[model samples]
Target chain A: MMLKSKVSIVKGLSYQGGLPMLSWVLHRISGIGIILFVGMHVAASFFVHVVGTDSNIPDLLNVFYESWGFQLFIYFCAIFHALNGLRIIVLDLWPQALQYQREMTWLEWLIFIPIYGMGVFFILRNAFAGG
Target chain B: MSARSTLRPRSVQPAWSFEYIMWFFTRVSGLTMYLLALSGVVGAFILGARTQVDLQTLLRWMFFPNRFHVEPYLDDAAFWVTAWWQIMQILIVFFAVSHGFNGLRVVIEDYVGRSFWRPLLRSVVFLLWLAMLVIAVFVILQA
Candidate 1:
């Protein structure tokens, strides 16, 4: 574990800039995002017991997807969270990639762009179609 | 520690109070988010189960508030149930954003002297959270 502890990321890269920092921060962030999302899912499940088959269910669902504001937020969150998670996993496995870190970092953005587009498409589809 | 990490008052003069407060807040928030996520998954299962069963036979006179005559969507049960879950899942988004923000903050600060470089990312995180929170509040109120 000591070797793991000594595993520093700065060794791979020669320069300091915002891009690498963003990825590093995002890697941690996406992890935390997933954790929190899972937690809220559990808590909200409890409400189902009380309001099981409640009439408000449809309206609530409609309200959520009916609006553009929530939809856009969700799309962005999903895209960034997922893309950043992948970046972290890759970095952890290949420390030497720091040498070509910029290329890899841009790759993350490349993947994210499409994912964001997909999210927007679905969110808009659901939002406009229903309400 | 770089000026970026050191820029925070805590790095300059560490104290039990600030650390303890931050620790407590994070754990409490983390646990809440964890449980919330769990419940949602379970809720999905529960709703799924209802779909397979004969809700018409079982739910008759059950006194559920949302009960009605029309088939809400995929049968009377599924549409209602899935929608209900979706409404609640918004909170999960909030928790997720918070958790992600906290983790990002640490990672950005981990670099030896990169505090100066982190402000922009931190600002982005804060703004996203604020916007998400505002939307969540509005949606929940509308619900």
Candidate 2:
């Protein structure tokens, strides 16, 4: 039974926990996502600096980065990661706050949704407005 | 009882260890980036970025603060080319690159476990981090 359970866990088919587990998983995902974006962004800036702004590469990169789809994904990752990081930091500094983890997670979502929604709205507006 | 007294305290890793140092740095650098980005946003508005540049240009300026990013949009891009903005650009590049690459290292170490590839990958990441810093700083200085 133990071996079976371990295999299931390795396969990522286990129940694990719930919200807390999801939060931890999402945190890792978002962190990786942000790093990937940053790598591309920094490289683009460096390339533009070297080749000058007249090059088509900057325009191509800008088109990809400015798209509403990419913006939504990036903004979600960035906002979620930032807020969840603060939550983790609070828990680390004040261990007693562990008792309130569920509440904090809920609070995080409460805060994240509105900010992320606003960003999404603006991104869509810009894309539709042909800007 | 006071919150300090109620806090659980344990010492597993020494403060001088690489893991410990990086753990502390991750938090510090994350907070530092927030402050830097906040300043960037405030400074951008002060310089009339909202009216002068599009969303993309404003974002580019916010992230890098390089005059080249905003100069095409503004009639007077002189303010962005000043020493103060250059300093901000350098600081943002330094903190963002270091923090990001370190996070990648941590992720690799966590998932890769004990393997020959672990050290190899870590070295690769460190080299890339160094290269990125050099390129980013050079670009900022040149701009």
Off by over 4 Å in 2: A1-6, A9-11, A52-59, B1-14, B49-60
Across A1-131, the per-residue lDDT of candidate 2 in tens digits comes to 11223344556846667788899888888988887777777778777878777767767777787678888888889889889988888887778888789999999999999988988888888889987
Strongest candidate by lDDT: 2
Best by DockQ: 2
Q: Model 1, range B22-134, lDDT digits (tens) per residue?
A: 55555555556546655644553455535543333222112111222113334545444345544554555565556555665655455524445567777876786676565
Error of 1 at A61 (Å): 9.7
- Return the lDDT, model 2, position A103: 95
Candidate 1 segments exceeding 4 Å error: A1-16, A25-40, A50-67, B1-143
lDDT of each: 0.52, 0.82
User: What TM-score applies to chain A of candidate 1?
Assistant: 0.61
